[model samples]
Target: MSSSGRPPARTRARVVRRMQRAVPALTKTTMARMQAEMDWFEELDAEQRSFVSMVLQAGYSQFIEWYDDARDRETARATPPLSAAVFGTAPQSLTGSITLQQTVQMIRLSIEVAESELAAVVDPDHAAGVQAEILRYGRELAFATADVYAHAAEMRGAWDARLEALVVDSIMRGEADENIRTRASALGWHGTGDVAVIVGPAPSDGSSPEAVVDQVRHAARAAGLEALGAVQGDRLAVVVGGVSDPDKAGAVLAPHFDHGPVVVGPLVDDLLRAHHSAAEAVAGLHAAAGWPTVADTVTSDDLLAERALDGDPAARRTLAETVCAPLNAAGPDLMLTLTSYLDQGGSIEATARVLFVHPNTVRYRLKRVMDVTGLAPADARQAFTLRVAVVLGRLASNQR
Candidate 1:
């Protein structure tokens, strides 16, 4: 041993020379064996297979270089680390085609091939030393493979995050198109049913964007919904797909947001049209501050009056189209009776007297109004929405 406690230079050189000579045989044997033993190896296309072969050759060459240098403590202190250079022959895209486990299996097979060939080439006196070096090289290759995969995973995560943010922004801006659908597919968004959008304040604890998204996704999953979340400034927006009940999904995700009202929009048919839901949810989120007693997860439809009061034209149009137009089209009598009932603080007797009908007839018309507009005149919130829609409808009719 040298004073630095490394093998003598002559001994290291002898082992290195033996490994250099065994490279060609090692390459052929390893590739043949991998083709026969590994089922997935032969499935790669011609270019990928060629790249794999190149990787094997590079791995063999790098192992010899690393083993020889590792024996010399001073020379082994090189940077860029031996692991980073192990797969230098292959493009980074290779990782996308082959999994890390497959790579590690290939390395193990290559090490076996090297060990078997080295035993044949080296003299009995040096065979043990060479075998030990091959084992050490295998360990280094394993760690290097892990490093490569870890880096790949980090890059994939970053790309997925950017894609998710883009999808969310498109939905919020009501600009969802084919490109957004393709990107969502790449992110593995599997929502195929009713979709809704929820808006709330982002977590105030200064968590990373990834953590905030993960928290919202976890909550949404627990509620049996698929969710995609993004942080836009101080707000967190989550678009949930495959949800039949937006309010329930919002309630499940409410605790994950900061201390503010979490607003959910009405469900749309699919993600392609989720922008409508996103708009309503955003409008409701802005309008929610006015209702101190609002539920933690208030639906956008519940806040239609508030949203319209906040100057949201979409809310106004929705109120007019969904509430007033249907009632007006049902009949002037039904519309007048509903107006009278709401004006009289939902008193059936007063509405009946004003309309010159029995109280039961007024009750029957109220029920008819509920069926036509889906908003009952008795409930306070629905009544408020109906009244606003009536006023807006009258104002719109007058303008016409």
Candidate 2:
């Protein structure tokens, strides 16, 4: 034996020689087992297959080098069992194609092949040691692979969080430029669908913001929608796509937020107009406290009255344009009819008496108001909006 506790040089050569002869059969059997057992492995294209084969080849050769040191068992243990270069040689994109579980399956299959060939390679005395090392190396490699995947996932999550925040900030700032559009597309935004923004207080649940955003994305995906989101300062803003009704989208995400008003803006036709939705949702969030009877989730359109009362210029303008302008443009008769009906407790007879017209005439004008403005004066909530809109319109008209 050598002074270093290694076997004699001639003895060491015999052990390595037998293992080397077994390498070809081990490689063939491992590949065959993989082909039979792993459908994903067989389905890889030629280039990817070649890459996988090369990694396997490196793993085998690395094992032989590691096993050669087993005579000095402590030194073998100290030596890195797996080559760092082996895993690094494959393109990072390969991880995307081959899942960690599949990689583990491949590693375990290789080890099984190695154990089966052991008796043919080394004598029984050394064969036992080689088999034991094989199991140990397999466990180590599994952990190494887990570490690789975990690191990749962590890096990707951090990058996505930053990207999501960027997209959300641009929308909130109303910067729907081509640059922001490209970023949103990278974040899985479908440009062809209606889009809306929902905002609320960030959850104080103490989970990492990245985890919260991931949860939101997962939930949105399951609901057949695309979402981009992040917690910005104290507010959580999520832009949801592929939904027409803003209220339903808000409801889908409401449970993830803190206990407060979760507000959705009006749905816009596409992502480019998402900023309009974002502005309205943010304004509504600020004004939500004024309306105590609101549901946990509310729409920006639904909060227009409170928003206008809270001095949101957009809400005030929307009321004037969508409600009053249509009423005034339709004719003064609709305006006078809505005012008279509301003043007299929505009674058609009383309104007719006040307008000096037939009750049917009052009814006809009220129906016209509904058709022109989409607000039915008979409904208490809508009547309140109508009243606010008409008053704001008069103020705007007087200003003009």
- Mind giving the per-residue lDDT tens digits that candidate 2 earns over 228-253? 98898788899998986777788899
Best by lDDT: 1
Q: Please state the error at residue 337 of candidate 2 in Å.
A: 3.1
* Residue range 1-400, candidate 1, lDDT tens digits: 5675445788768868987887878888888898899999888998998888888887888877876776454553642455556677788889999998898889888888888887678777667767887898788778888998899899999988998999999999999988878988888888688999999999999899889998888877777778899999999999998888776788788888899888998899989899999999999999997787887778898899999989999999998889888888898988999889988887998888888999999989899999999988899878988888999999999999
Off by over 4 Å in 1: 1-15, 74-76, 352-356
Worst 10 residues of 1 by lDDT: 71-80
Task: Please state the error at residue 390 of candidate 2 in Å.
Answer: 1.8
Give each model's whole-structure lDDT.
Answer: 0.85, 0.83
- Candidate 1 lDDT at 46 equals 87
